[model samples]
Target: MKNKFIYLIYVILSNLPDFYMIRVWFRNITKLRAKVLKLLPNMEISNGVKIYRGVKISRNSNLILSKGVVIKEFCILGGTIAVGEDTQILSYTKIDGSGKVTIGRDTHIGRENDIFSHYHNISDKNILVNKSKECFQEIHIGNNVMLYSRVAVMGGVNIHDNSAIAYGSIVTKNCEQNFIYAGVPAKKIGERI
Candidate 1:
């Protein structure tokens, strides 16, 4: 379609001489970026969604960004990932949705966070780690959740609404609602008011 052609033009122009200059030009042009975002299949992006430069979105994936969602620079969103309204994913965050990742409304995910919806099977000691098949599971982050910097969310974890995860935490289990979780293999530290 016309949008694809425009995106192609943008890609070609961005790869030309003075790459940084062209990236800056594209960064300043929100409309141009939005137009490209609209071309993604199964994307239900609402109004006021801001996807900054250096963000990588997979071509063959379902990405839904609700109203007022902001994905900052260098964020990689792959596979099936749905971000709810008013959610902000800061810079350097990588969301792997090889299974499915559903982030609820009003959520704030800080920088350098790694969220994975799939994991490799390491049950068999005989099998090579790299050759093992990946196990897929859904990761759900409920409404009003706040995940601080450097948090790692593994697969099959359900983080309920109104929860805040502290920095440098590794979430391997379900998080209770309306509480603050911290430390490795994150535990409920205290209740959130």
Candidate 2:
């Protein structure tokens, strides 16, 4: 019951115009919002966490946001997720954590990135992909990783620490540590210096 009320208040506040004048009047709006969000069930948000306006977090989600984590405007987060300290998820990024998503510290997920931890099982040719049973796989993104704009990460992918994925890449396999990857079904391009 308390979570519902908090979520309602969040919904109302998130709809308010994010103009300078409005912010001036509500100087601590972001902080207030974070406080309310922190009260939700199964959510653990540390200090210095900034969740911008227009970000939609599902009520069913189990989220753990560490210190200095910033989720930019219009991002959608759902399911079970744990984001480490100092990580930033840029605008319009969608993290589907139905199968669990663990993003490490100092990571940057660029704009419009789509990270999913669940995929439809399409082994049966008779059934349509959409109608197929869903398979859950955890996505583990190590510390100091960077996923550029428009990157699409499929389920069961482990992005090792200190790696950088180029813009518009589609990652379907595990990425090595300290490497640079690019292209569809992303392949290693070079080592990160």
User: What are the lDDT figures for the candidates, one per model?
Assistant: 0.85, 0.91
Highest-lDDT candidate: 2
Model 2 TM-score, 2 decimals: 0.94
Candidate 1 wrongly placed segments (more than 4 Å): 1-28
Considering every candidate listed, which one attains the maximal TM-score? Answer: 2
Give the TM-score of each candidate: 0.87, 0.94
Report the lDDT tens digits of candidate 2 across residue range 111-177.
9999999988899999988799999999999999999999999999999999999999999999999
In candidate 1, residue 150 scores what lDDT? 99
lDDT of 1 by residue, 1-193 (tens): 8646755654543333333457676454543554567765566678787766667776666888888888877788889999999999998999999999999999999999999999999899999999998999999999999999999999999999999999999999999999999999899999987
Off by over 4 Å in 2: 20-27
| Candidate 1 lDDT score relative to the true structure | 0.85
